[model samples]
Target: MSDTETHARTQAQPRPSDAGATDAGPIQTGTAPEAGRQLPTNDELTVHYPCKYVPVELLAGFGAGCWPCTYEAHSFEEADQLAHPNLCGYGKSLLAYAMQPDVRVLVLTSCCDVMRRVYDVLRDAGAVDFLWLVDLPHLRGPREVARFRGELRRLADAFAAWSGRAFDLDRALASFVPPVPRVDDRVTLLGAHGPLSLVDTCRDELSLPVENGTCTGWRLVQTPPPTLGRAPHEGSCHVCQDGCEAGIPRGDDLDHFLDWYAGALLNQMPCMRMVDSKARAKLVGAPGQHGVIYHTMKFCDYYGFEYLEAAKESKVPMLKIETDGTRQSAGQLRTRLKAFDETLHGMAEAHEVVTRRRGADGGPTYVLGVDSGSTSTDAVIMDGNERIVASVIVATGAKASRGAQNAIGQVLERAGLREGDLTLRVATGYGREAIPDMDSAITEITCHARGAHFLAPDARTVIDIGGQDSKVIHLDEAGGVLNFVMNDKCAAGTGRFLEATARAMELSMEEFCRVGLEWKRDVKISNMCTVFAESEVVSLVADDTPIADIVHGLDMSVASKTAALAKRVKAEPAYLMTGGVAQNVGVVRALEAVLGSSVATHEDSQLCGAIGAALLGLESLN
Candidate 1:
């Protein structure tokens, strides 16, 4: 080994006294331990695979102890011997484990902000030679399989560099199944962890093959594959059914599922609050093909981000479902799992196919995107080849649908096309719901992310200020929304604020931009509320404040408010500015100054939402 490797070994390997010790409190692992139990050797270069609490199937493909799996530590003191009192304990523990010699690689999903920061720490620490972070998008359907395959290929290249072991997909797939000869009669080492546990308490008390590790309360006690296939044991789980259709009793409550995973009672993975980027890279990268990513609460922003990162690293089909931990949702979860299982099974043999509406004589298709805003509605039309055909914008009124229809009609008319000629229509923005005729409605957050991504693939941050609100979104390379922050509580420096101030100053929006650029002195607008700020501006004018200086102060105020949102979302550059406010050169300058980086804005910034909606429609067709 090189000197660098030797140095790492000295700092990373645990002492013999630390045997069977876990970072998450005390673990019982000595005399009563399972037969032949052993920890990965320090010299073996084990990778830490931290899953978001799922079943054993995710760990099936790789050889045992090739990676030492552990649920993340719950607190900082347990994780890092000298962690700060106020620091997020989850990140600390994951990081502490990552520094060990047994952990040469760290794999994790982007489930939350904590994980993202954790990843940053791991990469900056320079302990691991190979670090990869996967940005997992919302896995609602099968198209994600293609995305996963591409990510897996990229990961294989990285693994080859770190481990000097080339990944063979065929061999990997074969290994993904359990060692048992027949899957039909095979038993599974199942565990109920993460969101599943929250949803199903009967994880234990089930007759599964083996139940070990954290988040398993229900145990699979038998695997007599031969005779068991016909008439499996019942009465083990009267609550959640243990995934056996026959075992489900008509009047039984969902609590039987609780008995299915009994091991989780032993320990649980770290909460979203504790995760960070290094932990994510380690946990997400650990899985072989056929990994299951568990995303708990749908509204939980932290875990949501972590799920995204994990999805990015996945090599096989992954199933993501949300649950509120209520028995009422158990049936839905079961159905979702059934669908996921079928999809995973067919992913390999299934030929690539595109679904589209039949065209006249089988001609090409076209997609249209409409972005409805408080101020205006814009439309962008794209052909089947993803090329822009025409764009249109119309002033918005009380009725957003009318404005959208008018914009789309104008775009179609400009292109000399008919409404029936379009194959898909996607609508996006705050007023998206108002346009009920759209084929689909996407969140403005996603639309803006995609639009910015399409415009500049390198852009990782987007700062958008529209007529009524301001937003900051962080995106991965492929234009996936990592997370975002919106000024939904109040309108401070939005276009409306600018317009009101411009009117008070007797200037047009264009003049406001020019006036701010000529300011020689800095002025402060302390109040951010529109009415109060407007009054302050009027007072400043009456007090002989320079028109240039006052405008400069207004621009500064806009930057400060928007910058606060950027900080909240952990903004990184290159940034793209969208929405109506992008037309103001002075505000852009102020934003750049506050952000300490150059900002990119296009002439069609106001049309980004429409363009994004159109793109999504096109993607859906394919």
Candidate 2:
């Protein structure tokens, strides 16, 4: 071993006194553990594998513990420094685990190109005591099984040499167990190997039983081959000329056991990398599944195609989400998962969103809908007759709670009422939870679809461009949300993007609105990134480009991106532009041109979220 390898070993391997490998948490195999079952301990060494295909039982026979290398990184600084910046987020996260000071062993398959590069980087860095890249084969026929068996044997030998331990065939056979079937209703997480934190978040956000059915989460291998192990003289092994002693397979017995083990690992539920992986759809839409939460890692192509296929063929509702495996995306992920939970439960079960307290004297009951957004807080007061009696919009400053209070107070006063007069106050928006005294907090996606239907009865699609995010919602004939897509992680193609450009041009948003319509020449602003687009605006200003034309370009950029999102959800005509951006006539015109259809807007477009919230709240009272 090289000096670097020796150093890595000293830093990583646990001493005899140490407990088993650091707990990577439960693997979330969608089944509860068997009652009173015990797992073997490997205090000396822990072998970590990042994929489901890893043969944990084989490693156990060598007295090495096995754990799923599902580390979600605080940041990608270490991985980014060592590897390309554009590596898939899953690979980056794995690299973070490998580079940890105490990572003794890591095993990864050539599941994707990025992962192969990850192996290369780790090999050069000598980051762990033992790093092995299993040469995964796409096919699982007899030939492939034989090839995989050889690889498994090679791995067993290498690990034995590294740990200075002999493989005990009985221990390996003992580790094998058939997967307990999960038959209960569940929300299945499909697609890529998601971080363990993602599973925890699902449990937190969802009311249903959460199952991590992703490529890494669900690992099922057949129990010891019928021919192989017989407890203490029950039968003699066919391969062992001498009867198997203490159930430890030797010579041909070991080979026979490995052949079965290899087939089990290869022929089990295949991942996207495998040729017959499309058959893995059996994992989804299981009996009593509430829905599927399909996750895709950024820049990883393996799962996205499968996600599309699953979404198309799904019998139950499916929510597709993408993450870059960083803590920064946590808030966005929470919002998406929470909203998805509402869609599955609220829509599927026809659950009532109950609102409390109407007037005892049968006076006009009123519900207040408050949308506490980043830029502005909007409140709408609706009476029992579905009439919007009063509305207010207030600039949300440092605190969303304060802005919500201000909007609620002003709207109540405008309606000649006090807070006591309100029957229900439903909150919607990113800041919904930050507000106080809300009867209930609902997602903006659900609210917007409801509000758009009420505001424009003919509309089948709703386009909402808010300060921090943009969303395109597809609605059914009754204004129920069928599907929605959001660009929440980045400020691009949002109201914030235009605001930054307007500031760069030293113009107020009001001026930006009118000036954009007066453009004489069309300019293409290719960059959609907020910071880069603002720099582009500054450069245009430096070149003395007309402010009207520059503003028009910015509007066109936003419109183009919004149109693309609309296409993803298979949007139809009769579109209603809601949220704060609808007030900007420039964006409306640009959108109309790009969509090749009239994008209708209402005077109360900014209050759509609040209106929707109020409508949903009133439904409970009815």
Candidate 3:
């Protein structure tokens, strides 16, 4: 079969690692050299490249050390000052790293608009001693390959002149090594490029081998086509436009090596930026592939579009994540990735065998559930009859475990029972794992689905707007989660957004909600960012805009974002609202208008996750 056909069929087989495992080691920012590669002495210069497209072998041939420039900045202040604030987190972080004194010479690619702008800004500011921007082609054609080959030659000559070193053909030829194949069942990350930190977290959290198919994650190497029995027609090679009768040219042959190198880089699975990105289908459809974690930058529109397309075409389940490319979102990303893993490989089932409480004979038995969240800790106690014995809610001060202890203690005290009185304890929420005394932990998505179904038996969808995240869950009649989506990395559609808005207006949440519900004007808030929205609100207040109208606009903004999220997952009705933000009448009304349907909420909506956990505990005991 032709290489293209083989590649198409290879989707049914395991894919090889992007770069060989040895070559694609952990990204390094410091002068510490990578393993296997020669370490650079104080007198020697190192060439730092951001993307995989840069020819590291060529750099090594010139007697220069090649280092993958990946580092997490302590702050984006330096980057923001150099580049636009709206630029991608990865770009900003790269800029920040480039400004450091150690980054002497930098090589970058014009892969994306952000990178191009970064190159422009850095070059203009003279951030580094030497900088080169390689012009990458989007397609694997003869002309493009020749063009790239010339660019590579130019790059080599420029580097040689700058460092007073000459390219060693023998060394460059010897550096070429074939990649080994990967065979384990793994998850593939697609969409915008991710940093090493995010990639490592995905691997660790999912506890599965993860193959990075994103732009920044994988590097392509040259693979030759099979030898033909007879001379083929000119330009008949299916993989590349170069029409050589022989297979891929070896690096030892200088003239053919450049053509081979260009073909090799272009023939690999194309990134989302490429016009023809169908090669990604193989990555997503590879054998032993469990799921996909589609990551996109917050301000990047390119990968966002690709994510939607990938999600639609993917055979396996997929999760979409957006980040600003900062460590600030690490905790949130962990929660989502862990929850996705649980969904794919079902969570460990609670033991069927039940242990009775001491003195259970002729006495009431109880179960407990605690939900430790960002804003509040909630606990619920239920009797053997499935009746609520007591419930408590309190602010979740700095520590999750402490807040959990306090909330559970309050409920247990109210029920006139000690901790030992409970048969089982289940924890749920963002801080679920932090609670030490809990017997089991469940994601809020599952708990909310169960609780919503119990509260409103006919409910088909649940919209949960919590302190720091928002979730839309589709449920079956039996309270089982069918599917769900969450927005945890941002505060745009969460209770925190409302709280921040209230603070900016110098009004209590209760007052803000009340005023918002009473507004008659149709004011709109365009900005979804918490900080920017607060400033917009301040400006409106200063302009003598009615408080009610401004509050209404803020409520509408949250509702609009929530509605869009719900639509993404094909939300059905009857709709039930859960989590803290369910208490806001204005938001509920605005959501109804946007969704064109009424949303049901009860007084105990905020405690739904806790209630669900308690119910699960009772189920396990039975």
Extract clashing residue pairs from model 2: none
Top lDDT hit: 2
CA lDDT of every candidate: 0.57, 0.79, 0.75
Per-residue error (Å), model 1, residue 501:
1.4
Candidate 3's error at 122, in angstroms? 3.6
**Candidate 1 vs candidate 2, TM-score winner:** 2
Give the C-alpha miss distance for residue 129 in model 1, angstroms: 66
Pairs with backbone N, CA or C atoms under 3 Å apart (clashes), candidate 3: none
lDDT of 1: 0.57
In model 2, which runs have C-alpha deviations exceeding 4 angstroms?
1-44, 231-253, 281-287, 312-315, 347-355, 358-363, 541-546
lDDT of 2: 0.79
lDDT of 3 by residue, 154-179 (tens): 88767655555545545555455455
Give candidate 1 misplaced runs (Cα > 4 Å).
1-355, 358-360
